[model samples]
Target: MIGKARGQEGREGAAGVLPAHGMTHYPAAFYHMTHLFYQSGPPLYAGNICTGRSGTAIISLMGETQGRVLLVTSGKELLMEMTPSMSGRGMELVCVPTLKYAADRLAAGDCPTLVVDFGWLPPSERGALLELHKQFPKTQLFTLESVASMAPAVPSPLRRLSWPLPMGFADQVRVIAKPVIILADQVLFSTGAVQNAFQQAGVQAESLEFGAELPDFIRRQSEARAASARTQKPKKGWSLLGGDEEPEQEAAAAIGNLVVAQFTGSAAQAGALDAAVRAVAPEAVCYLVSGVDTQRYAMQSLKEGQPVALPREQAGRIAGIMAESAEGGETRLKQRERERILLLDNFKPALTALSQALIGHGYEVTSSMDGAEALRLTTKGSFHLAVVGTAITMAELSGAELAQKMRERDPDMRIIFMVDQYPLKAALQGVSQVVELGLDDAILKPVEASRLIFSVEKALERRFLLLENARLLKETQEQKNQLELVNGFQKKFFATVAHDVKSPLTAILGYAEVLTGKLKAMPSEGRYAANIQTSAKTLNVLISDLVDLAAMESGKLRVEIGTLNLLAVMNDVYERVKIAATNRKLNMTLEVPPVLPPLAGDDARVGQVVQNLCTNAIQYTKEGGKITIKAELKPDRVEVSVIDTGIGISKEDLPRVWERFFQTKEAMGMRKAGFGLGLKIAREIVQRHGGEMGIESELGVGSRFFFHIPLNGPPPTEGAAGAAPAAAPKPAPPSGLPPAPRPPQQPQPPPQNPHLPPQPPQRK
Candidate 1:
């Protein structure tokens, strides 16, 4: 039954017989007997090969006949079974699971030429294959689907009379040859979907199911094969694939205090290195000497203080050498030495005198009689300090205004304010103005030389102190930044994970909601759906709380300040939470005076504060408990309180109740579900709105939490803790309970009124 199918013979066979195995029980006879090879010798090919694709196996069998077989399939067990069978038939077999692995081997310029692609792969693997194909265009792509629809034309030399194929081979196994009709035995299944996919991918597939079609398919796969060998220029020499023999040379100028020296054919390089050290810094000067004489010369110079020397033995100790040098001690100071000083005054003589005084102190002074000229000079140069007169006769800017401009230019700049005379009462005004302008000091005019010198020296000293402090502060800030980076990463990770988890939970909740309505007639299913919705909501709440906490801690929370109607805010909260309160059989009430004034805060955030407090009350309270929300217009502020008869806080626990994640014993006892962040977030919001939030409670009684915001309403300004326009902060009830009873000072001796019998127990 085994047969060889050549050009004419394959055509007749394609039209002839069908096997009785339903094309499933493929005999091994066709694998050996089918002679369908091209005459171009060993050709390049690549594609996915797996059990599901019949053409891939056929292509693999063809490759085995002429050369080695490289199987690309993830099914290792399947390959293991096929390996021994293929080996017994005297063929070589190699298997790679992923397209990437196979492509990599091919790109190394040394791998098998044939690749058989079978079925759909992941996009990434397919992309790797496509990229490799671009690199080696001679490499052929053979698909099981593309080959099954054609009757392959087996060349004369490639055709055999009779060869026994290994077990489990079938010529009837179907393949999807794109847009071609071979005989029923060789026809492909599911050609439409595969062809459409190939079209979308811009792949031009050649059919190989017919004998007449073999030449064209081979032509496409071998388009560049003949040209590739003729075009390749031979490599010139043996390349060092590891690396270059010589290392890369670093730029000589980039070498800091440390210096590198190389001795060229001589033992005496010390003289040359000494000259080099003089060109840079004397305090540094490390020598890397191969000869003992050069090292001795360097050590002798160091001993005589002519120059410093670094040891060749200590060549590895770069950090230690840097530490020993003065260069390390004054790195920051050297950076700050290019200091400029600005002097401004209408009196040119005084200005010149003061300028000379500072210049004598080694300061570079830029002088100007006109305030406008001084500002222009500052613009032209960077200044470390400024000396400004109290008054100047300039068209553009006044002296104080000029100082303000300088401060704006560099907030760290030291400024000294000078005046003509220090009037007794007026001196305070001048001093306040000087402080407000951020000037270092204000000296009266006709200033004595000693006084001016003293003041200037003090200012410079203060400036140096500030600079040193700033340097230290920068180091501290770097450490702080590292910690903040870690915290930021953690926060972002939590936020991202929470967000990702929330998406699926949202879908689940949505589905459950839909199911709840649909399953109303089935109580059991409806109950399950309700549970799902409730669980999803609880998870959503936890995620929301975590996100809000992160936002608050990272300073990302924002509130828009405006005049808010307290009554409306309270009423809105009541309406939102009344149902929950009623469900617990708790009495909830809202009290707002009709003539209350508007408070200053973000309306939405203020509403959140109220809602949180009310919700907390509802959660904590028992049946028949009462909750009251009250808002009133105080003399300078609007006060809002949420009072509840609940499991009251203990004395020790009262202070810590606002701390995040600090759940109380009562809450834990009730097994309430919460993140314990509401009060903390509420307090932060209130503080951000320029308000004070507090609490009062007595154990076993009740708790009242309240916040007060200014009615005149000056919310905190951006980047500053500007106080609200309210009166000075007055201490509210200092404790959560009424003030403890004071001990009688002297016991009052039964009221030094022993005579009046305590006034008959106080007349009514």
Candidate 2:
């Protein structure tokens, strides 16, 4: 059974057995026990254990110690087995089972060391350890893992140690041949452990408690080494003919090879150190030896493939990693240097400065102060990307126009625009236009080297992505087939629905007419029946139009040509639409030459076209508007026009009126009842008769729609009319008769008897 010590008596008894070490003061029992567990291994003592008010077993030792150390693990037995070995050594061990408890212990006070057992931790919970370390960087951190063999040779900071420590642990943790510098607290350096560790690892190590002097020290060392190397160079051998002169040696690199830094809980200090290292050695491999937390110095380490933070225990791997990184960094630099960039700016100073900055970053840069010269350069040599100023001064081609021409030359090249900040709205609009035009990106000037580099990288990345997508789409034949199938199915579905509704709609119209007649004596009921009949007729026309649209889309629309009597077709249409016009209080008229030449066309379709025009005019026209259907004889054909005093179409909208499903804004506002397919269908019919259709209109001023059909009928090539054309030559209009004059006003025609069948109008 484990014994417990509590209160002052327990604290006194535990303190009596502790040995003194010249370090920070801490509770005696914990200080002794932690050292015993770390140094002597396993359970050696258990009698000094004490329980706190919170029910956790804490061993309190009062003595001078290095600092308090927190051990977090899930293995309760390990703590129980090791509790008895708490007598000497200046360290404290507080064991907790989870990270939450570890955080709680940390919140209590200053703890300078923490050890985590990874065997019991989950991968998902590993990030919490980094957070804990970030919160408490003063802690000397370590980890114990059971599966160290499975870790990568160049392990990340979180996976630095293994349980059942690997062979030659001290040797494995050595820094090999590279020099190491340790920046830590003064007390840490005084302990001698950090220095001894580096010494035994066979590396020259220096310690600096203050971070400010590191950069100057490095710079001085570099200068001295450079001076020494220069002095050591052999003098060129002389011959009378200069044949024995030695080849000049290659210059030493300006950047250092590798640097390892230990962060002492100061972000500004760490950043300064990083900047200094970069100034002296841009390609140097920097290793940040952080505790369990790495978030502290993340921002300070900006360059890719430069600094990777590692656990303090992995200091030995730095030298090996440095050699590998150096080789890999050179390869990457070469690849970057191969990327050719074209810079175009009419402003000479800006162009020169930007060119130099890009070239310094290892890009091959070609710059031009004139837009035309820049274009010529692009033709002469290939470039991976172009950086252009939006305002190109003293040039015939603007930046935007130049970009378009360049794209025409090579579609794959990536482009980025540099825009000025003045004229704020225009700059914003320019940025938007860059995206709209599918150019890569836009950067607001004055451009910083860092920002420009970042933009260039991202644009190139997008270019590659688009190219890959285009290649994939080309190879996906199955997707194309599926798209075509979907379109075909949609057309078929619309046609099927239209056909199914036609039968029911015919019955509805017939029934409504019957109801109207039966309920005539009842005025209200008769009105309802009439309304139903009217609605049914509108629906029938819409359905017929939909059916015709489907047929035309599928290329199945056909015209059965026969002898067409212009007078009879016009009169039939006039009678059919006269009731609708009268209901709306609109005046309608039809005028045709008294003697007209016989034409070859489909009579029913022709009447349908004329009726569609009359219906549209009625729908848009205000009350008491006028509509005229006029036909005149021409030398080769007859011209028929539908003139309306309804709302007129704007000139811009007139061209689009013939397009299917397109409605003018005014037309839609006045009547929301159409699919806008009537005009499209009517025009298609006219074209199928080997004729052309056109419209003239003015907003709010009425419109005139017309078509011309040959008198000899459609040409022989137009699939021969059902009958021969009448042998009569074209007849002239009545002498001294004005064309399309309105008749004198007279009494309104009486409504047709509801029970009487309607009769077709006779030809003039």
**Best by the lDDT measure:** 2
Candidate 1 per-residue C-alpha lDDT over 371-410 given as tens digits, one digit per residue, 9 for 90 to 100: 7666665652377777777776466666666677767767
* Model 2, span 1-764: residue lDDT tens: 32233334224334323322222333323322222223346543323343222223344444554345565655555454433332233334466556776676666665554566665666557557866866875544555445342232222222322111235543534533222234433222333334444455563455554556667767765775576567555555465546555433433332232223334544345545655664664432223333222221222221231133334344333233333333464454333335678888766666666665665555556667678777776752388799988887436766777887887787888889998888998689769869776788898988877888899889878877887899888768778888889878968976998999999999999999999999999999999999999899889888998898888887667677877877788888888888989999999988876656666788888888888888888898899899998988765668899999989999788779988889988988988477889999998777666566778888998988888776545544333433332244232222222333323434332223222455455555
TM-score of every candidate relative to the true structure: 0.31, 0.42
TM-score of 2: 0.42
Among these predictions, the greatest TM-score belongs to 2
**lDDT of each model, Cα atoms only?**
0.53, 0.61
Error of 1 at 426 (Å): 56
Which segments of model 2 are wrong by more than 4 Å? 1-133, 136-358, 361-489, 716-764
Candidate 2 clashes: the total is 15
